[model samples]
Target: MDFVNEDIDNYAYDHTQIEDDLLWRLELETYDQLEIPQMLTGRIEGRLLKMLAQLVEAKRIIEIGTFGGYSALSMAEALPDSGYLITCEMDPVAIQFAQRFFDESPHGKKIVLKEGPALDTLKTLTGSFDMAFIDADKENYLNYYEALLPLMRPGGLIVVDNVLWGGRVLNPQETSDHAIHRFNHRVKDDHRVEKVMLTIRDGVSLLRKR
Candidate 1:
């Protein structure tokens, strides 16, 4: 069962802004060269990420899961000259592909790729951050949230991708679905933050540490 009706969901995607040519190229290349291409954040969501970073005028950003660095590059393009983005990815192959693209872009210097498990990397990062994006392992969504919350400044935004797990969260049968379901419910009730789960892409839960 789809959490959102088909007609309404289709309308939402239709109304959203489309991606530019460069991002479109990257999206195409990701599908062409990568095995788990679905892991890459597509055009629509990449634009959203860029817009969100612009809105916050974020100086320091963090991203877990740099699958081909699509999302990282998108957000990096939106940041000001002084802004920086620290992105982490556990997969070495994906990191290599992402690094290739990052090296070609003008904003590449702003993006610092950390190749390692995100949980371990997160521990090394201290002090407040302006924004964060989590799109890694689904089962550890809550763990990522807890680890990042303390590092994010009050009112800082945390955009988590794939929370709906391709509408699986509505079915209650899939393991990934249940994990996201639990994580969403937990965030809704968490007193330390305020949140809204938007049906963007699979789903994106936006959180603001209070």
Candidate 2:
């Protein structure tokens, strides 16, 4: 089901702040080059990630999925000079696509790409992070959240993408949809953090550790 009116979505994009040149190129290139271009964070959602990183003054950020690098670059640009970002992706094509742009951006040095299962990567990672953005396989949402939670510093933020699963979360007939619904429920019931789910694009759940 359509989550929001197409006309309103178009109007919001029209009135919102536009993307920078590099981000614009990323958006276009992803559609042109990638098979699943819709996974691209796009200008609007990318901007939101950047703003959130800046708002938290995040020094260390971790991203579970690195589809074409749009979201990683967006948040990396807002990072402080010494800040660093670690993004994990299972696809080789996505890793390469993202690296090409990451190497070009001024914030490129701030990003570290890990190509593997996000759950495994999280296990190997050390130290607490200021923020984490989860956009990986829907089936592992709860696993990623559980593994990453201990790695987050107190008051750190966690941004989960596709929570509504294109509104499929309502009935959850498919495997992916049911997984998202369960993940959403887990987050809502967890006492360690407070969360708000927003209907942005597919959907986004922003959680802050308490």
Candidate 3:
């Protein structure tokens, strides 16, 4: 189901710099202990997230999913002294593990973990956000987009992960694939934002609110 050729993917990983010692250990531990460790963003994507946060100079960030807090920490490390990242996760168990890492790190204070349905929590947030990372439920991709749009400032970036759904998106048979395909189509024609789908780890759709 991988869209990219295996050799190319290997080459990409080889060319990219690996994460630092602490992050590398955290990522490995998450995979060893968690049920769905694949959900955790690894070295390549984590660095990409950090770089994007830096590019935007994002002061206030929101993450729809905080799997083991890997991505949250990655972005938080890129933030300025006053920047903050509010990350929400639906699973209580996952939240606990993420919190453990957050508490041990210097950037921990900047990360706020809200445990509950991301959609419901997002609806209650009143302040504007400079950036957002959406890696939650697949069926609610569009819903998440709509919910966050009003709160995202113009020129703000919203990155949606797993858009390719492990290459299932290219197929018309799988239900998840169809859902993702439809979501991609919906965003393509939306007038409120500018977007491009990048073939990152799992295909990330980067949208800029207009």
Highest-scoring model, lDDT: 2
Task: Order the candidate numbers by TM-score, best to worst.
Answer: 2, 3, 1
Measured against the true structure, the TM-scores of the candidates, in listed sequence, are: 0.91, 0.97, 0.94
Task: Pick the TM-score winner.
Answer: 2
Give one digit per residue, the lDDT tens place, for model 3 in 78-103: 88878899999988888888999899
Q: Which residue pairs clash in candidate 2?
A: none
List model 2 lDDT by residue over 121-206, tens digit each. Answer: 89898868999999989999999999989999999999999999988888989999999999999899999999999999999999
TM-score winner between candidates 1 and 3: 3
> Candidate 2: which stretches are off by over 4 Å?
none
lDDT of 1 by residue, 1-210 (tens): 235778986786678787666667778999999887888877668889999988888889999999888999999988888889999998888989899888888888999999899999999999589899999988889999999999999889999988878877778786778888999989988999888888776888889888
**What's model 1's TM-score?**
0.91
Backbone clashes per model, in order? 0, 0, 0
Q: lDDT of all predictions, in order shown?
A: 0.87, 0.92, 0.88
